[model samples]
Target chain A: MTTETTDAELTIWRDGRFQADEWTRAAEDEAVADGPAILPLERFLAERDALVSRNAPLGVSVEPNEAIEELAPHLDRVALVTLNFPKYSDGRSSSSARLLRERYGYVGEIRAVGDVLIDQMPLMRRCGFDSFAVTNPVTRKQLAEGQWPDVPFYYQPTGSTQQAEVPAGTRPWARKPS
Target chain B: MYRYDEFDHGFVAARVDQFRDQVARRLTGELTEDQFKPLRLMNGVYLQLHAYMLRIAIPYGTLSSKQLRMLGHIARTYDRGYGHFTTRQNLQFNWPALKDIPAVLDDLAKVEMHALQTSGNCIRNVTTDHFAGAAADEITDPRPYAEILRQWSSIHPEFSFLPRKFKIAVTGAPKDRAAIQVHDIGLELKRGPDGGIGFAVYVGGGQGRTPMIAHKVRDYLAEEDLLAYVEAIMRVYNLHGRRDNKYKARIKILVHETGAEEITRQIEAEFVEVRKTELLRLPDSEIERITAYFAPPVLAEKPARSSAFEAAKADSAAFADFATYNVTPHKAAGYGVVTISLKPIGGIPGDATDVQMEAIADLADAYSQGEIRVSHEQNLVLPHVALDDMPALYAKLAEHGLATGNAGLVTDIIACPGLDYCALANARSIPLAQDLSNRFGSPERQKEIGELKIKISGCINACGHHHVGHIGLLGVDRRGEEVYQITLGGSGDETASVGTLVGPGFKTEEVVDAVETVVDTYLKLREGPDEPFLAAVRRLGQQPFKEALYGTA
Candidate 1:
């Protein structure tokens, strides 16, 4: 119900990079960073054996539930590909992060890097993401409004996304036998 | 008949407000067409050939006179004075402006109605037999269960975004009036050996680019497990059903590829997990609470048959023909169920003008218990009318142009809007249906050829249920000229199958005569009056009919 209307007013950042309104060839440019670099999932998969040989943690964002058992062992330290909201309706990336965490059991840092509508932060946490990179700039009041939608951490197993075990008497779908 | 309590009414009002906001956003350019499309579709608004079509859910095809009167108001104020009933026991309005939608929804909300999940890839309005509470063969009314499903599935968070739209139909009677077999999920209610009511579940049956019969997922799922079992099946489909191709996304294809056994095994595993939770148990008290809302109306003790009504039927051939064709047996011995044919001879099958709707609503209030139900066959029913009041009711209906003496006869066709309103249609179905009705307009002639189902579709989508008609007419455009392909011997009842195509296609002008030829041949070859056209065609095949039509076998 907040009255702020412009997308430029809210600013967010993820993975040590500040999201900006302007774009350049560098944004689209592919280069190997000297220290560490984030990459798309397909590119990482293309160079997986080489990266695995070199033991480098290549970062990439994935679609929802796009993981296989084979990708589990190598993704422990790699930076995972997350959403930049090409479209809010496109939920492929949310599924991607969940699959990586639960199905592959990846212990790496999960980041919400792009077009991460600040309102969805709690949902992001519930879906197993530990960190968020909010890109929309907001006033202090706007930031407060965009902080979180609801309580985080769903206690039950759902879809391809797994969850942390629930505390006693907290999880409602779970009931003791009569 | 399920009355909305305060909670239900508040929820519906909230939904209307949410949609009003969505519409505002779209109008103000805050949302684009792509973003709005899914939102609108979820609300049952579709952008059709000329204008937007709003499909209102007539849950289990049951309606009160007040609801019909509201629809009549919509027809007059918001639309072009009519509403078209679809095969799914829902009504579709062809023209409503984008801006006026919110107002229309607001008006509908006043009557405990909303168009939520009427379209879109989620669980749709759960349909059941139109004669749900009143059918003679029913073990129990299916509407209460359908209402429960409708409540459970409406805007459910986990199930809102599915790979494709889903349809479910349930039937309580042994005779399947709901056409359960051709739906995405078909449930036949049954009494188990333990004397508990349960369901036999069928999944994957659908009609579209690929027509499929549903596979049995479970034979007897207890009533308490119904919601959970349904949830399990949907979860499996949501997680594993293909999304890469629209045509292969239906549960039918998933069942075919993974095999029904594997699908059922997966669902059973999920069902076990779901049952371990507390949400699956719908208490008997809760079931009874829902059922109480649909309790039968109070009946005044009266004679089972009216000698005055019988004399009137015997006095006039028209009245007798109307009574013979339109009236059906009531569950209560003293009353009768009347089907007021919306499809008058040579008129569109399911189109009713605003005035006609008002007239029927008045009749419903005066005679029946202020209730009206829409049949899947696109006819309206006054489910419980005293036998003594039928003649007066018929007289009233006749004045409004709704007293056609053809309910299940040759002229009582199930037809689609076709090229007249649908952009996807290759030919016109309503005109063809009108032509056929005109050819066989005589009441005696229609009575002689009794209990035949003739379904016509403008295209292969089978909106008119042409695939399951005893005599099916499919409109196809051959080299840019409209021609129809005829199929025979199909049935949509407990024994359901796609009809086989017969001979070559006929031109638009010749289709009606061709249908006549087929019916005339059936009349000549049938062994007795009990054998219907479907049975006769099945027993004798299409060889003799083809010979009679084309001069050689």
Candidate 2:
């Protein structure tokens, strides 16, 4: 439910910087695009075999609350998994991304799309999102200007910031430098 | 009592910088109100009826004299001259502008305090027994665990966006003064069969429109497993709790819909997987690190009896009443825990002025080891005062109008800042509390009906904790007129139960009489003077009180 549904360019940011986006979002009523493109989960599930056989860097977009178990078995084929925030307040996809990473062991790039604001970058990243579809102009400028949300330390070990070793005596179990 | 380390200091300073930026963006209209709401709430700012209100955390109800004085400074500078102590043992300033919040936070951070996570859907300020390190009956100090939780839950990623706000309470003593059973997550500190520290965990207990007592999930979880077990529970709740309806979004509803056994099974399975991560198994060194911050202050031992206290009581009846009502036994010899009551006859329950706060700070420095605690019951406790200082402390407190001599009596009511200040309130509650206090203003009458708790909430949200009050009053609007609904027999102690609704409703003008009538009925029906109001209600049940309220044929 983002109010910003204006026609705008969608830029994909990944691996420390924004690059030319190879993935195109296919319009629902139109015929499928030729190159690397993402389809809704239902279309992907319905045309699984055909799409898998002719795959050219295929991806699948999921609703925020969609059951991730349905997409778990198809993890081997997809090059990217797109999770939606819908709005900044709706956070079911964080759970979905974690399930994909920790439960299904999906290694493909998981990109956060829709209502991807600047403030949620760190949380969205820590919840296993490796890429983001930058449509929000403010967030785009924020990302472009090299400003980012980086704290001195973190409390929990999840996603990218897991504490792999025991910390020192001064601050153990906590104070994992980020 | 925990002091900020270098890391903590840096984090707080960084957070203040971030919030200041957010405030600048908001004022410049770069961030919409909807976008700014959660951000402001995360920093403990709320847009109330007239202006923004700020809530500062008093972690686990523990406070130092310097920190208390800082709060007074904030009250005097940024807010109305007064601050209200909330049921969560936090402080709420009724008036703080949105622009002023960043500056307010700066002042707070200087004192090693911040308003972080005091509001919003994050794990709120970790509350525990106010008598944590000083109570005579405490098995271990719960503040260390509470501090551990405060750190772990701060800026938490997954849980920061919970379905609904979560509350957790911990208690070291078995008496349950922290109201553990009513929290979303309750941890009772205890020793296991191996004589090692552990916790008895309870989950999904809360009071709101639908109140349910928490179910015990684990009888004994090792102290090392505290964070891991709690993380498992939070994950289970975050994934499965219903999000379709806001009212049913609490973990309590999830625990209710999914049977306790099934929820326990899910949590246990999650715990097995989460413990594999090894990041949260609290090391003994970490526990010791936090526990050292709460080490009790050294006190010189004295005789078992203080002749000065005895002689002062003999000299003045007022001192005798104050000694009898406000003082409780301390774990240290010849020391007493003094409760500085905020409630006065026909006055606000928890409102303390900046002057009064500074006075408490001065007195704490003078008499109580420079340590103070904010009780959940809306009173302040001086944790370690010598018995011989009773008269002097009472006199100084009296000069500042802080000595009310009603710790657990009728006048010591817990009333939320209802329609007077809160935008969510449906009707007025503080007015009714004022009226009731005046009606029972007589010390003789209050002493006769000893240890009665009257909690009032302005709405069904139950911010006043009326559901756990021995006598609860809930305000409702009936056809544009404010009225009240009464509930009885609720107890928040170890024997926790939601109060049963008594029948009918009373007008605003009549609520005071209705409460008096209920009290008088209890006085008549009691087995004797020794039987407290709650005990009589439990023995006789709601039928007798119901008959007395509406009258029987």
Candidate 3:
């Protein structure tokens, strides 16, 4: 796993294009700082009271199999939730992202980190992932140029607000395509 | 058949463009074979034994005359002048250069067809009863719901990367002609007590190495909750289905390990949350709109029986045999459903030549309201043919060598493209099927035997569906040579059950003899000539056949 220094300044793709990343992910056993920080769910739970006492924004990092119910009560305080994809084929994180957005109603920036590929970007975006931490240089460059393959229309309604462009009065639940 | 809307057209067109780009990237070495494999599979391209096999979805077995002609065109222009229709109601072109795939897809798109999700760890082609709209016993047509599911599961973001491939089948008739019992999810449309449409949902049924029948998850699910409930099932499977072992990754294993009641509880719990979301809930108007597209064609009611059809049958014995065995009663008056057997004597079961395809297409336009349906049993159905047109259609079909009057008899065998074409096969299946067809080639003898399903699988993958045949033959390799194991009493219809092993095994040459012995045993044990082989096997357990095969097992 490649690691970047906190001071190197990172960027993430959110909504449609690249933007400067806001929260910094704290290394293991690192103390909470004055700026926004993202910590693993285990570490946050271990030092919750102490982190809650601080005034800075806080977030939690979740693994593919981690339960979102554990993070539900703290959703109000957390502004970002990062889900890790250890491998591209292990798709547990996609379901976790949807659970956070649709089931738990967590209104926060859900970021996809690790092993994110250009082909999966469209799917991840549809599954309630608003931001992506692309580590692959080629995918990062592609994201920067907005050159990833995408279909403007979708068959299923997803976490995204975009509606399908079917005829009016055909389906009440259909979202009109923008 | 349901026509594609502008949205569906755009979706498939964009997918074609995306796949073209991916193919280019793979050729340029920007993507490795490992990376390109899944992408190509999602578009229904497979790396077969000899070459890339492209499987195109027929969308619940419904095809228009124009679409059938397009497939004929693909078979002639791009492939080896032939196409194989699969059990999933799809067509496979076994020989096509990878460079020409994009062009083939362009042709398919012109006819409102695609190969999307035909092969992959995703929701595959949604199959249904081939006699969907025209079956006399059907309560309601299931194609509309199948179409709805097709749209909902297409490129599903969350479920696309599942642990294993998923298959769903729907049937509106009480008879399980679609083999609903052997699918991951099987929906049986039923009318509620209050006269509203609902579904009897079955989950976790599949046929492979570990063959198991499905368990009913819901006795009745409202039609409006179809998408939400299906998504709920998918979500549960996506999260809890085992990713550790590829062999045990199907939802069947998960249902087996977790218990059906427990899985149902989880699905209901998930449904509580899923149903609340407007994104997943299916609206009534949408179902209505889809249902309108499949509305039965208007047919003028004629006399119940046709004089011309009877006269033709009386004049010719071959026509009489064809009419008796190959034709099914249609719901519309004076109309009959004709099943043109792809399994001619001593021929590949589902393979059709380009000329045969074009002939079938022309016959569909002339006799069946410009519609054709592919049966899961590897036959083609003209669902609304007028009885008066039967003689002409039969004559045309005979010219193409497709007018085999053995639809449900001994010669109507279903065999997968085994070692001859498939890389995963252990032994050749088509040869055994051909040998048996020759052994029982006589139409008189086939009629005497009556409605025997002999399904052969090349390997344990059960692609040939041997597990559900009345006399099933499973080809296995024994000490570097081909051997076949026989099973009896399997059926893939409303009373679906896996067959039981009759005895040990047989050499390739003796396998056909072994099958004959079993058929001869059934012939002796059957109460009357009217009793079918499956019924006889059911009446008397495997004991009689086992004794006949192994001398005292």
| Candidate with maximal lDDT | 3
Kindly list the per-residue Cα lDDT of model 1 for residues B377-488, writing each as its tens digit.
Answer: 9999899888888889888898899888898888989999899999899999999999899899887788889889999999988888888889999999899999999989
C-alpha lDDT (0 to 100) for residue B144 of candidate 2: 95
Top candidate, metric TM-score: 3
Q: Which stretches of candidate 3 lie over 4 Å from their true place?
A: A1-11, A15-35, A161-169, A172-177
Interface RMSD of 2: 2.3
For candidate 2, lDDT tens digit of each residue in B1-553? 7998777888889989999999999999988998789889988988888888999999998888999999999999988899999999999998988899999999999989999999877799889988889889999999999999998898887788788899999999999999999999999999999999999999999998998899999999999999989989998887788878878998999999999999999999989977887768888988998898889889889887999999999999878888998998888999999999999888898899999999999999999989999999999999999999999999999999887888899989999989998899999889889989999989899999998999999999999999999999999989989989999988778999999999888999888888988999999989999999999999899988788779894
TM-scores for candidates 1 onward, in order:
0.83, 0.94, 0.95
Q: Write the per-residue lDDT of candidate 3 for residues A1-178, one digit (tens) a residue.
A: 9866442255687767666687888999666666999999988878887777778889899997777778887788888999998877777889998888767778778989988988887888778887888777778776777786767667776655322234323444333245
| lDDT of every model, 2 decimals | 0.77, 0.87, 0.88
| DockQ score, prediction 1 | 0.11
Superposed model 2: Cα runs more than 4 Å off: A1-7, A16-20, A24-34, A37-55, A67-74, A102-105, A159-169, A175-178
Candidate scoring better on lDDT of 1 and 3 = 3
* Predictions in order: chain A TM-score: 0.61, 0.82, 0.82
Q: On residues A1-178, what C-alpha lDDT tens digit does candidate 2 reach at each position? A: 6554323543777766776677888887676788888988888898888776674888899996678889988989888889988777667788788778876788888989888887777777777888988887877888888878656466666644321323423665544543
Two-way TM-score contest, 1 vs 3, winner: 3
Q: What ordering of candidates by DockQ runs from best to worst?
A: 3, 2, 1
User: What class would a CAPRI assessor give candidate 2's docking?
Assistant: acceptable
Per-residue lDDT of B154 in model 3:
85
Q: How do these models rank on TM-score, best leading? A: 3, 2, 1
